[model samples]
Target: MAATFRRAMDALYLLCVIVGCTALVLISAIIPWAVFTRYVLNSAASWPEPLAVLLTIVLTFIGAAAAYRLNLHMNVGYFADQLPQPFRKLLELLVQILMALIALFMIVWGESLVEVTWHNTIADFPFLSVGVTYLPIPIGGLCLLLFIVERIWLGIPPDPIPAHHEVAPFE
Candidate 1:
C-alpha cells in the first residue's frame, strides 16, 4: 500500500518536473521570438508575451510543489539544527504541521480564486479562462498536502536521485 502510494508520488513528481521544464523551454523560445519580431521584424507578436506569462505561472506553482516534495524549498534551518535531538524532532514536527496548514490555505483559497475568475477570459487569448491559468495554485497545494501526509506517515522518503555532488570549478 505504502509502496503504491510512493510510486504514485514519484510519478507525480516526475510529471511536475517535465511540465515545469517544458514551460521553461517554451518561455525561453518564446521570449527570443518576441524580441526578434519586435526589433528585427518590426512587427511585434502579441501572443508570445502573454503566453510566456501564462507559462511562468505554470512553472512557478508546479515547480515549487516539486521542490517542496524534495525538501529543496528555501528555509532557515540553522536554528532548527542547533537544538537538542528531542527538541529538534519536535520542531521538525511543528514545521510539518505549519506546512500542512499552509497547504490547506492554498487549496481553499486557491479554489475560491479559481471559481471567482472562471468566467473571465484573458485579453490575449479570449478562449482561455483566467481561472484555468489559476488551476496550478490548488493543484500544487494538493500535491504539497499529499507529500506532507507521506512525510508524517512514512517519514521522508529517500530521494530518487542524489540531490548534490561535488564538482570542481575548473576540472
Candidate 2:
C-alpha cells in the first residue's frame, strides 16, 4: 500500500511537470514575440508579458514540488554522514519534522496571501490577478509537506532505509 501511494504521488508529480514544462516552452516563445512587437514594431503584445509572468510563477511552484519529491532540495549530507547510526536517524527525523512545520506555516501564510490577492485585482495585468500568481506558495507548501511526511515515516526508529545504508552507518 505504501509503495502504491508513492507511485500515485510520483504520477501526480509527473503530471504537474508535463503541464508546467509545456507552459514554460510557450512562455519562452512568447517573450521573444512580446519583445519583437514592442521594439521592432514599436507596439507591445500586452498579453504576452502577463502570460509569461504567470507561467514563471507556475513553473517555480511546480519545480519546487518536483524537487521535493525527488529529494533534490538543498541538504547537507556530509555533516549527517559523521553522526553515529542511531543519532543519524534521530537527526533525519528532526530535519523532516522541521521541514514539515515550515511547510505548514507557509501554507497558512500563503492562503492568506491568496485571499488578499483574490480580493484585490491588479491594474496593469488586471486580467491576471495576484491570486493566480501567488498560487505557487500554497501548492508548493502542500507538496513539500507531503514529502516530509513520507520522510518522517521512513526515518522512524529501526529506520526503513535499505540494508546497505544500515550496515554502512554512513551510507
Candidate 3:
C-alpha cells in the first residue's frame, strides 16, 4: 500500500512539475515580447502582464509543492549529520515541526494579506486581485504540510540516504 501510494504521489508530482515548467516557459517568453512590443512597436498586449503574473505565481507554487515532496528544501545538515542516530531523529522531528508551523501560518494569515490587497486593487491593473495573487500561498502551504506528514511517517533512519533513493545534491 505504501509503495502504491508513493507511486501515486510521484505521478502527481511529475504532473505538477510538467505543468509548472510549461507555464514558466510560455510565460517567460512573453515578458521579453511584451517589452519589445511596448518600447519598440508602441503597442501593448492586453492580457500579457496580468496573465504573466498569474502564471508565474502558479508555476512557482506548483514547482515548490513538487520540490517539497521531493525533499528539495535547504537544510543545515553539517551539524545534524554529526549527531547520533537518536539525536538525528530528534532533530528531524524538530525540523518537521518547524515546517508544519510555517505551513499553518501561511494558511492562516496569508488570507488576510490577500484580502487587503484585493480590497485596494492597484491602478491600471485593477483586475490584478490580491486574492488571486496569493492563491498559491495556501495551496503550497497545504501541500508542504502534507509532505511533512509523510516525512514524519517515514521517519529518520540515522542517515539522510534512503536505500532506494539516490544522493541529493546538498548531501
Candidate 4:
C-alpha cells in the first residue's frame, strides 16, 4: 500500500514538473513575442501579457508544490539542526503540521475564489473563464496535502537523483 502511494506521488511530482516547465517555456516565448510585436512590428499583441500572467500563476503554484514535495522549498534549518535530536524531531513534526494547515487553507479559500470568479471571462481570451486559470491554486494545494501525508507516513523518500554529482556555479 505504501509503495503504491509513493509511486502515485512520484507520478504526480513528474506531472507537476512537466506542467510547470511548460508554463515557464510558454511565458518565455510569449513575452519575447509581445515585446517584438510592440516595438519592432509597431503593433502590440493583446494576448501575450495576460497569457503570461496566467502561465506565471501556473508556474508559481504548481512549481511550488513540486518544490515542497522534493523538500526544496525555502526553509531555515540551522536552528532546528542545532537542537537536541528529540527536539529536532518534534520541531520537524510541528512544521509538517503547520504546512498541512496551510494546505487546507489553500484548498478551502482557493475553491471559494475559483467559484466566485467562475462565470467571469477574460477580456483578452473571451472563451476562457477566469476561474479556469486559478485552478492551480487548489490543485497545488491538494498535491501539497498528499505530499505532506506521504512525508508524515513514510518519512522523506530517498532522493531520486544520486548526490555524488557536483554542481558547478555559474560565473
Compute each candidate's TM-score over C-alphas.
Answer: 0.91, 0.77, 0.72, 0.94
- Cα lDDT of all candidates, in order? 0.90, 0.75, 0.74, 0.93
Return the lDDT, model 1, position 50: 91
Judging by TM-score, tell me the better candidate of 3 and 4.
Answer: 4
**Which pairs clash (backbone N, Cα, C closer than 3 Å) in model 4?**
none
Q: In model 3, what are the clashing residue pairs, if there are any? A: none
Clashes of each: 0, 0, 0, 0
- Regions of candidate 3 where Cα sits further than 4 Å from its true position: 1-8, 42-50, 114-128, 155-171
Scanning candidate 1 in windows of ten residues, the lowest lDDT window is 162-171
How are the candidates ranked when ordered by TM-score, highest leading?
4, 1, 2, 3
Candidate 4: C-alpha RMSD to true structure equals 3.0
Q: Which ranges in model 4 have alpha carbons more than 4 Å from their true place? A: 166-171
Candidate 2 residue 5 C-alpha distance from true site, Å: 1.8
Best by lDDT: 4
- Over 4 Å off, model 2: 154-171
lDDT score, residue 97, model 3? 95
Comparing 2 and 3 on lDDT, the stronger one: 2
**111-151 per-residue lDDT for model 4 (tens digits):** 99999999999999999999999999999899999999999
